[model samples]
Target: MRTVIHKLFFVWDFDKEEKWLCDMAAKGFTLVSVGFCRYEFEKCDPGEYGVRLQLLNHRLHHPESQHYLSFLEETGAEHVGSFLSWIYLRKRTSEGAFELFSDFESRIKHLNRIILMVISIVAANLYIGIFNILMCFFYHNEANYLGFINLAIGLIGSVGIWKLLRKRKKLKNDKQIFE
Candidate 1:
């Protein structure tokens, strides 16, 4: 009746995540909730629903969030769940395709926001990695293992940063097409 999936994806890869959710919906698995990197899906009629993702920087309890959720509900989108700043919504496929941002400018702005968030995370990881490396060099103890962990974190963050920057550049170049 219900299935759970564990997966991890960078925040900037939201498009991929949305596509995966849509694929699941097309296979009769409707998403019920999301916890961290876990997804809970309930079996339903195939092609019955379409999933959409919305990014809201506001806290869950914020009045702006409540108002936005209300507006989405009015538009026939059901609020399934939220993780951090991401809101998961679903709507009946028969109602037509669900798109949160209809204009090119809005899409660009959304991508810019995501890019900035990724940059901040990358910076934090880089700082921690440098600090750990310096400590390991000065202390020269068994705690050096932490330096390797930090290095890995930094590398992962750098990859995310590179991907986000490339994505932003591509979006900017393709902006004219959207216009």
Candidate 2:
């Protein structure tokens, strides 16, 4: 019973009617007796453009009920094409306390990807570090230049591991907060 801003017009109040139409359209014949207002809703009538009163119901706005909107269309309610689409606020977990576990799982997947990339890069760099040191000894027999390069690469790989350890600590702290 909520108030609706109607665009319908009676025969007596016909002059106030919209320019593009001559009969009540979306009023759906509810206003048939506005002083003999026989609804002459031609296909091109402006009343065809008004909102359907049924859409204003609270039932359609509930979180679970939003699913009905799509089902309504599928069941031949073609009129929904003109209305706004419904939204869903779905999450991976329905429970409030366990929702962060879902979030942590997503973050852990991202961390695993990063760890895989770091492992591949570090493995390649360590191989290069060992080769440079060995080449310095075997071919040129000079330790200073290649030893410094190997040491720098080793330190960079160690720093990468340290950064990953710090991120893991932060992730652990976040998971504990959820518990």
Candidate 3:
């Protein structure tokens, strides 16, 4: 049987999202598909597979991403799903463990990628919001309430960026310790 779940996970919530997917697998559901705010899972033996997710440096179709994914596949990981630049992979429990980044440096790089994506979103939102507000004032249009919506989104994204930066800082400190 297949189960579909509709949920929202912000860009900075990747760790939470990954943990939720693993918890679902522990309960006998294995992720099969992913989309904007939607996840599809198929019933499987509980604890049969280990789940891992990564934020790619490029889109799945890009040659660099394709090659990296192919490398992972050669190591016995199965590509489960992708949404935007994020990819989900699963490996049999018998494989011991599934980890996308084994070192602090690699993890830090992944965090950087996520931070950059969030920054882009924040910038776009703020720019659009300001533009709409200006237009509303000049044209005397009330329907431009979308300006407030965009500004709100920008504010939320800014919080996410700050959290990501803090996470990255911790990773860097940890890296220095092991170096």
Candidate 4:
């Protein structure tokens, strides 16, 4: 029975995901936090104590007396600071396939995709523009050097300009940009 319990502990541990933590809490499975060999007992509350958060395998180094809450991450007890409880879980998201990206990364990826697409189109057009400019200047003997300058500027400014314009177009637009 003891061996099974220990194995179960390892299997149940998950990163500090809200949905999983919330579900575990709803299931009445209290997290037991124990200090390592050299460490000393800190506090009864997971909030007040500096215990480890949930690991990938659900089994943390829980020892004996500690506060376990239902909602927030399994790290500590209840507190206002728990708002960032989603941090650890989100941090792990990048390592796994079906995990949520952080707000900043999500935004950056979305913006990057849009920028890349626009740049690709503009780059093709820039090549076309350059071709036209060459034909006019060399073939027709109408030296328009300013045409190359404009093409350079367009390529450099493509990303920054599009991001600013599309960011606030609509609430749904931002979501759509990422997909």
Candidate 5:
């Protein structure tokens, strides 16, 4: 049997999303698919699988992505699903915990990739918003409403990017402390 749940989280809150997925798995709900903010879970024995989330910088159609997925599969991790640039993977708990990056340096590099992605997105949104606002002023028409909306979205993206940068900074500091 399958169950579906609806929930939304910002891209920057991926840790929270991963934790939620893991919690569902702990309760016998193995994630089968995810679209938009909805998650489809299949019934399974509690603690049957351990889940891991990864940010893939490459496009899904990229040849390197296939190689990366194949590498992970060779290591016993199953690629369950992918959305945008994020990939979901699972491994049987009996096999041990699922860890994609074992070393602190690799983990830091992964986080840096995520931070760069978020920054790029935020910059793009801001640029679009400014352009829209300029167009609205020049046209003096209904486009003003859309301009405002775009500005709001850009503001939200900026905030999200700020939060991600802070997280990245913290991770770097922690790495320094460890080394």
Candidate 6:
């Protein structure tokens, strides 16, 4: 049997989302597909697979991304689904340990990708907000509300940017200390 779930997790909450997916896998539900705020899972043995989520540096269909995913698949991790630049992978527990990043440098690089994505979104949202507000002055009041909503979303993304930056900084510091 398959199960469908709807959950909301902000960009900054990716770690939390990963945890939830893993928890579900532990409960015999393994992810099969993903969409905006939607997850579809199929039945599996409890604790049969380990899940890992990554924010890729390019779109899923990009050659670079396809090659990277192919490399991962060769390593025994199955690409289950993706949304935007994010991908979900699963490896059987019997394959020993399943980890996408084995070193600090790779982990830091992953964080950088996520930070870049969030920053881009924040910049776009801020630009849209400003443009909408300016256009509202020449048009109608209703559009001003859209501007405010965009600004609010940008503000939220700014918070995520801060958090991701801190995380990247910490990873860099750790790499320096251990290396």
Which candidate gets the maximum lDDT versus the true structure?
A: 3
In candidate 5, what are the lDDT values of residues 2-84, reduced to their tens digit? Answer: 89999998988888998898899999999988778888899988999888888987987799999999999998889888888
Off by over 4 Å in 5: none
On residues 12-72, what C-alpha lDDT tens digit does candidate 2 reach at each position?
Answer: 1212442222223333321221112222232322333332212112344576555655554
lDDT of each: 0.85, 0.42, 0.92, 0.38, 0.84, 0.90
- For candidate 2, what is the TM-score? 0.36
Local lDDT at 134 for model 6: 84
Q: By TM-score, how accurate is candidate 3?
A: 0.94
Per-candidate TM equals: 0.91, 0.36, 0.94, 0.27, 0.92, 0.92
lDDT of 6: 0.90
Model 3 misplaced stretches (Cα beyond 4 Å)? none
Candidate 6 lDDT, 28-128, residue by residue in tens: 99999999999999999999999999998888999999999999999999999999889999999999788898888999888888888888889999999
List the candidate 6 regions with Cα displacement exceeding 4 Å: 134-143
Kindly indicate the candidate among 1 and 6 with the higher lDDT: 6
List candidate 1 segments past 4 Å from native: none
| The best candidate in terms of TM-score | 3
Write down the TM-score for model 6.
Answer: 0.92
Q: Residues 93-121, candidate 1: write the lDDT tens digits.
A: 89998888877678878887887877777
RMSD of each: 1.6, 24.5, 1.3, 18.4, 1.6, 1.8
- Give the clashing residue pairs of candidate 2, or none: none
Residue 60 alpha-carbon offset, candidate 4, angstroms: 45
**Between candidates 2 and 5, which one is better according to TM-score?**
5
Ranking the candidates on lDDT from highest down gives 3, 6, 1, 5, 2, 4
Candidate 5, residue 77: how far the Cα is off, in Å: 0.8
Model 1 global lDDT (CA atoms, 0 to 1): 0.85
